[model samples]
Target: MKRQVIRSTTLVETLAGVDRQSRFQHRRAFTLMETLAALAILGMVVSSLSASLHLYWKYRSVSRSQITIAQLQRGIIEDLTSDLRMTLQDPVAVRAASMVAAARSESATEKAGSEQFLNVTEQVLELPTDLRNQPVHFIGTSQAMALLHEQRNPRFDQARSSYQSAGLSHIVWWVNSEGSIRLPLFHSGPQLITVAVNASKDRRGLVRKARKDSGGSASSTSDEDEWLVAADVTSLRLRYFDGENWRTEWNSFQQQALPLAVEVCVTIEGGPEQETPVVIWLPQASD
Candidate 1:
């Protein structure tokens, strides 16, 4: 009886030991192909996760930048349109015959009142080569001479005299090499105010900043130039609507007061063109 019991215990112990050895061999020995496949799967998962994170960050940055640019554009456009709608046509000329002397200095040439006068919101000045009855577009204000000269004749010599005799307003725009929009308002001959500042040639910016940062004590060359109706700008392009057609240029002068409507295109850098032009449909006033 004791020998039979001892033999059974030994047999059970031998079976348990064989089972442990088999499990250890199975875990320790794997084919090269099987190990490579496992590693490949792990690598694929890590790569996918990294790619997903990169794309998410990129999209987030673009979206944020787009929103900021849009907000600035909207604010500027709305203000311009509101002022234009209130603009009248061919009102009484404030003073048609106040002659301003032609400026000798290019800076002094583009003074207000020297070559242009405002009738309500309309400025009455002469053209260089006799426009006869051609339409006029006043794109900018002469801060240097704001309401001072109120006259212009594009041919007025800056070197000869401080007076151009006569001229309405002029429109000129150019995009610079460093991505700057340089728009100068020249009345007699010199540039008065510049829009979309030179970012670098910030003489204008400095003057403006002093006015803002110094609690309003900064002296400016053209202080009386007030901002009148302006084209709503988008992506550096401005479209003008003349009631009949959406125009990129102002061709004729029917003296219909302000433009019938103005179309502004907005395009941001590194993004798609804005599909909708900010159509500033002017509320026509009585002729």
Candidate 2:
């Protein structure tokens, strides 16, 4: 009877210890459903954060592009305004000067003698008496414009070191797809301003060419003179306001006067508003 009691007590103690251990393990470990729910919540939080970051970066890029384009547009408008404001509007005098310059350029190219110089003077005197000149210094089209404007001599321009005096300069503004264009004034002759848009797959941009008079001859435009005003320009349109209405074309020689205003629209790639139009009033036109 003593041995039976001792064996029963030992078996009861062992069973109780096993039950306590099982309960402790159940309390320490998580359920499969709880673990899956926690994991799903974590995934959602991470996905939401990633999407927010992506949107932020996308908006940042677009904003930067738009700012750059706006700045470029402002610069273009300012330059056009300055040039048009200083345009030399004396049609007869401009026509005579242009002719003389043309004759001189041709003579220089041929290495002619004093006879060529005399011919330049004679040609200027022989201009037709008609009030409307045949070839005007100011010519404007939808895509391009050329005019005789007085450009201020830069006090310190490394590119235009030869420009000592500020005089009536033949200015041409146009869009060019070609990588680069070099126009030698001597070779171009009377057609000092040539608007050529070559089909190029490399790049497209707005170009400004200026041929300034040095002494009696028109100096050849250097690389600096042929400036790439704006890059990645898809389209450029120029409209002239003649006080009465807006026209796609204007010839000072035919109209015998400058346009009252000019509207320039430039379209560039990678901008919020791909196209921007700037209107510049010509002060000389009012006079």
Best by TM-score: 2
- CA displacement after TM-score superposition, residue 163 of candidate 2 (Å): 4.4
lDDT of each: 0.40, 0.66
User: Relative to the unseen true structure, what is the C-alpha lDDT of residue 208 in candidate 2, on a scale of 0 to 100?
Assistant: 66
**Alpha carbon deviation, residue 253, candidate 1 (Å):** 5.6
Using Cα atoms with residue i matched to residue i, what is each candidate's TM-score against the true structure? 0.45, 0.67
Q: Residue by residue across 1-287, what tens digits does model 1's lDDT show?
A: 99999999999999999999998777667665689899999999999999999999998998987786677567646754544443333332212222221222332545664334333123335433432222123342212110112243222223234323233322222222244443322222121333343323422211111001011111222122112112222224555665576555432222324556666554545546654567777665332
| Model 2 error, position 277 (Å) | 1.5
lDDT of 2 at 5: 98
Residue 11 C-alpha lDDT in model 2:
93
